[model samples]
Target chain A: MLNAQVEPYQRLRENLSQRDRSLREKVMTLEEAASFVQDGMKVGIGGSTMSRTPMAMIWELVRQRRKNLSCSRAITSTDGDILFGSGVSDHIITSWFAQGILWGLSKVMRRHVEQGLARYEEWSHMAVGMRFRAGGMGVPFLPIRSMLGSDVMDQRPEAKQIDCPFTGEKLLLVPALNPDVALIHVQRCDAYGNAQIDGLQFMDIDLALAANRVILTTERIVSNDQIRRAPDQTKIPFFCVDAVVEVPYGSAPHECFGIYEPMLNHMEAYVAKVNSDPVEGMREYLERYFYEPKSWNEYLALIGMEEVLDASQKGRSIYND
Target chain B: MTDTTRYTAAEILAILSARQLKDGQVVFAGVGTPLLAATLAQRLRCPGLTILFEGGVVGAFVEPGKLPPSTNDQRCTKRANMVLGSADVLLLLQRGYVDIGFMGGAQIDQFGNLNSSFIGDPAAPKTRLPGTGGGNDISSLTNMIVAMKHEKRRFVEKVDFITSPGFIRGGTSRAESGLPAGGMFRVITELAIFGFDEKTRRMKVLALNPGVSRENVQDNTGFDLVFDEQIAITEPPTEHELETLRSIDPERMFI
Candidate 1:
């Protein structure tokens, strides 16, 4: 029989032990996490135009020649189209692409639809409103009047059309998006996986709630007690988290606060190279970054911090001291 | 006061420049002519006006003379208070926070319907340009909307696609649609300044540009260009307005 007097302390110790074990088992390298994403899986990414994204893992997936491993259904607020253009994704459900700079990226997406390589579903910003509302309400679907007479309805036949018995106005039904997995990057997390997103709260909050499982890559891992000390900032509670990988400079080439400056030169070079020779450029990138890495540290070493710093100084807008 | 008869871009600048602007006034600026007008309004007219770009930069400031290609131009980020996602901007508009919206269309009918979606045919088009880029929302919501375009075939008898609802058939349906009252108040063009009729809401030419005759304006337009009995030439730019507009944008005179 357990002693009642020591039960609370014993429970605390057990919780700590479980957290420690999970942290020990967390995948440190991008390649390891990339491997977890299988072929023909619908994936949800967390980002918007020129903001937070899991670029490292995406780059690794391309490098490893992870063929036949395509996202069956891809969803993002923005920037995911850039990934799709890089030959990473097949199908997509999104609003707009690059906000107009890369005009006809949507045209390319249409070509993919024409060739039957993938299916494309164009959503308005209203769809985002409906999805978030459904996720927050824990409902299966939400009714909205946005796509009533628009071409969006014809594109998404799966969306149920219902007549408003009261007004007789047609409303397009958007399905609740419960993603198979949500991969997010945050500023800080605890050993037990309670995460805090310091800067702009894009769609991370809703994404965390809507996804079936959450995998987080964070800048630092602290004690659970530290997170509890300041509960207001802890956006994602540990209960919802499936795994927490503490990767310093994890949002590298993308700004993660108190970590590293963004790799803007790298991003620009990537955009230019991809625009010039997409297939060959990606192949060269894979050979240079992934296959050549003897280990994770070797991979990290190849991206020199000094080079990033220099690039930042030379007119690249990266957050650094 | 007597010099209020010679029209120029600077005089047009003065009309927007005299208005008092509060902080956080969401100004949605369209491309080309409206871009100049809005930029001048911000720089010379109202410094506190928060310019919201269709490409998603909120409260962006242009560096003295540079006009960006689009709202998402890199310079826009460099000179912005905050860069919001396009989706977020649309959300803000839906909530009715946008104060003023500016738009231009290829064809605007007597009913205030704009056509920018297609050119020749819906099924098969001769020249299919970029369809409506958020003009639908911009024309619908903001407290007041300003329409600017060079009056021509682009400004036609009837638009091919109703990309935006201007006066939407008439005032009754427009008000019923929950659009703000005083719908589509003004239409500014290279040749004239027109206002919607009180009862019909059809565009009535109020003033003409200097050196532009009624016949020239009518000849260029596909529809019957309405005119007022007392239609006068617009006032020319003052030294202050001209200097300010020129200083802000030296390359083009959007008047």
Candidate 2:
């Protein structure tokens, strides 16, 4: 369906002198990215646990009060928890819940699941990755050796046990998952969306390709020359990205690897807030941070850019060499 | 003040768990107490131990002072080895590349079956726990060592759900179920160390922790235990092991 068609929805980055039609034509504001998300849409999010999560887009979705989203990711932390807490997401398909900087259950997610406010389908981390891989490869299913002889096979409806065609060995088959839209945050990206992911790539590439649309939220927007300087660092190409939004400290409270350490104090405060009056505290938190800030710059300013600078400097110390 | 002489029950459990690790073996560790025990092993006795986090971090050299918040923590990939996607690391476990799979569970049965999935029925559950990440794959493929405190509530006749694959119904059932060969199951708790019988696959007590009598282990266990005739008293943590373990987790969050 993606023929040589250049739809009007494809808006190129503004202020660029050389206007190559082939140059990525989908650079939008975060609001525009979240607007594409309709009620009851299955949205795939890419990140490894808390690190490099698309917290900016997640907050934007929460701010817009998008409802009935089916959140899909392999390792979800604060991003998923916030979506569930804000009552924006009703269903989650994930392998595991990576709690905030302190490793434990996300109390919000736990309460939702236990209280039947939300539902979940569990998979092994690998199983979900394989599902994304199969989706990207345009395959029906991927064979794996996980969840065999365990209750995960019985628990997850999408997981099936089938004998290998070649060896007749029993292997678990995970069905392909194609998300309507993928919200991914990366370390750096050009205006055209040549993204670079530092540290662990996780399943970002697979999720990006598997989704019908990719909404790339980047930590910073760099020059095309910088992207070309290190082509090997690029994980997602321009064609795979449908929209690009520049969100500095986009994965706050969760580190962006070579950029910053996770803000543990912020995470602890979030836990404390949820612990004391889960409903009112969450609403106040959303109002104070997400609704109050007109722009990401305002949010960063409230969080103290000095701390961000310090964290960025600290993280750069070990990786800058 | 750091006490050099005595250690807490959790510290004692961690020390016992750490002692099970070999020097040069690769271990697949889950989060929380399992991570704590593996870190303690790396620091104290088994310096060459390579830790594998479920987030695809391999051969992580866990340094002291900062406890990794989760398996996906960037610290998990610090300093050494390769960072792979989550699928590739679990693939290694399936290939039998890992030696030991260290795990902790909410509930464990006499047959070594673990439950971290849910506390009640799957349909309309009472308590829904986070489902298995790679726990089942690790347990099925590697030599499984369980680390937890000895409590009547945690140890049961049968788990609410078997999140990790153990010897299914005893004798030859795991192999019969098409699970790949390699890896036996062992249980390491605060009060005792137990290993499954070769034939029956039933948990048998090998040693009891100091100050914990034979009756204490029996009282805490939900199922009947088979005690070895020459069951030895588990050695208390040395001054150095205790100091190093406490130093590793000075906050005592997991310990």
Candidate 3:
């Protein structure tokens, strides 16, 4: 006897509105908000190759000397090799690491690997399978195809292949990686952390959904009603996001399309310097870009806006223009 | 003869340059020799042959002497026709967009199964190495799979592990899997070039480096040696090819 007029699933629909309300209130600056990442936490970052990384926050963390800050596990879809090469990361879970090529033969990441400064878990793309599956299922581990035939399995013996009783085919068992926090940079986000990622949404949705807490750093922050007007455009809804930060031109030096152009010539010079004398060059880069600056404004001042813009224009001429 | 005892890196570069390529053909460039092949293909054979990097840049144009240190070089973005995501690259590979795939290995068995994962034991690897990145997918899908490796003891009869499916358990099962449908195509070494039998996909010596003997080639490989009726020496590099290769990547001589 179902009550004809009574709605049984009213609570579920009502809960959606409340969740949306919570998302509209929490917003801050990237520097002000990243402090939420406490010591001994596992953090996931969103980007692929060199696109869409929270470069500003990464530089800020380096500037703060957030050394050995107690983060045990670091995960990303692509190896943010430059971040690792800069000495901020300790343990990494990724397929490959490189500066200009694969595996950081450019000396930035090579020096770290050669010197044993960082520990890493090298897996094939199947590792992404484990993470994404865990994020979707809300589970901690999943069985995957055996990559044991490759060098990855030999390097990380713990990620071994065991015989499946049902099929007898060897399957590699991977531990699910659900990060405590995930920091994502996007094109636009509302004050409540409803984010819109325009192009090539590289693992951001999976990462946003997988993390227990989500911090979004966006180039622009729009009003709540503007987000609600086109709800489908929001790739990450308010329910999944914990905080939002407004960061104009956030992915500087690496380009964010309409926001900033890539600085190719400067990037080339940096790459050359890093490749030749990594330790000294990295120290100089940190001093010039991060440590010497007291605030984000000061850091911006160090690499003048005009110079960055000029570099961007030059890059556009070379690449896009 | 003493001067020709070892095939210099320049000779290897020249041999690669002589290979023919067509426009719009997609070539998957791996880290070392493949990189050289791509650069050579650009310089001599087919300037418009689309160069695909596993890192997801397509139709990349690296300057002759300005070879990037790694695949993720920002220069790739500046020089690329399109920048794709890693997953998209995998999709492209599966879709048969790539024509040729270049790969390298430490050990290769009689069947052409490559091992780049370990030198000693499976469970407890004494010396861990860089494992197959996307070589598995590239090997399976590319129209032709070209293997390039320096001839040595470490690369022998039975590989420690099969990193990429070359000619698995003969060729019947591989064809059954609906893989590119062709057998393994070519194995290029510093000393010579080897081609697989059309049906068996078994290695058959096709050519030798100048002054290199069949015995020396057999001694270096782990499998039983097969010799062709007329094994020709590879053509020596012209002055231009040698100059281009040396000018492009002088540092890689050590590797």
As for DockQ, the candidate ahead, 1 or 3, is 3
Q: Determine which window of 10 residues in candidate 2 chain B has minimal summed lDDT.
A: B1-10
Which pairs of residues clash in candidate 2, taking residues 3 or more apart in a chain or in different chains?
A11-A25
TM-score of chain A of each: 0.74, 0.89, 0.80
- The CA lDDT at A78 in model 3 is 19
Report per-candidate DockQ. 0.14, 0.56, 0.21
lDDT by residue (A162-238, candidate 3, tens digit) is: 67789675566665555667777888977777887654455567677766677888888888788888887788877
| Order by TM-score, highest first | 2, 3, 1
lDDT by residue for model 2 (A238-291), tens: 877778998878988678887887777677787788756567777777887889
User: Which of the numbered candidates is closest to the native, going by highest TM-score?
Assistant: 2
Candidate 3 displacement at residue A7 in angstroms: 35
lDDT of 1 by residue, A87-203 (tens): 566765554333223222333333344455554445554465455445544666776544433343444555677876787655556766655566777878885678886544455
- Whole-model Cα lDDT per candidate? 0.56, 0.79, 0.60
Candidate 1: chain B TM-score against the reference chain B = 0.81
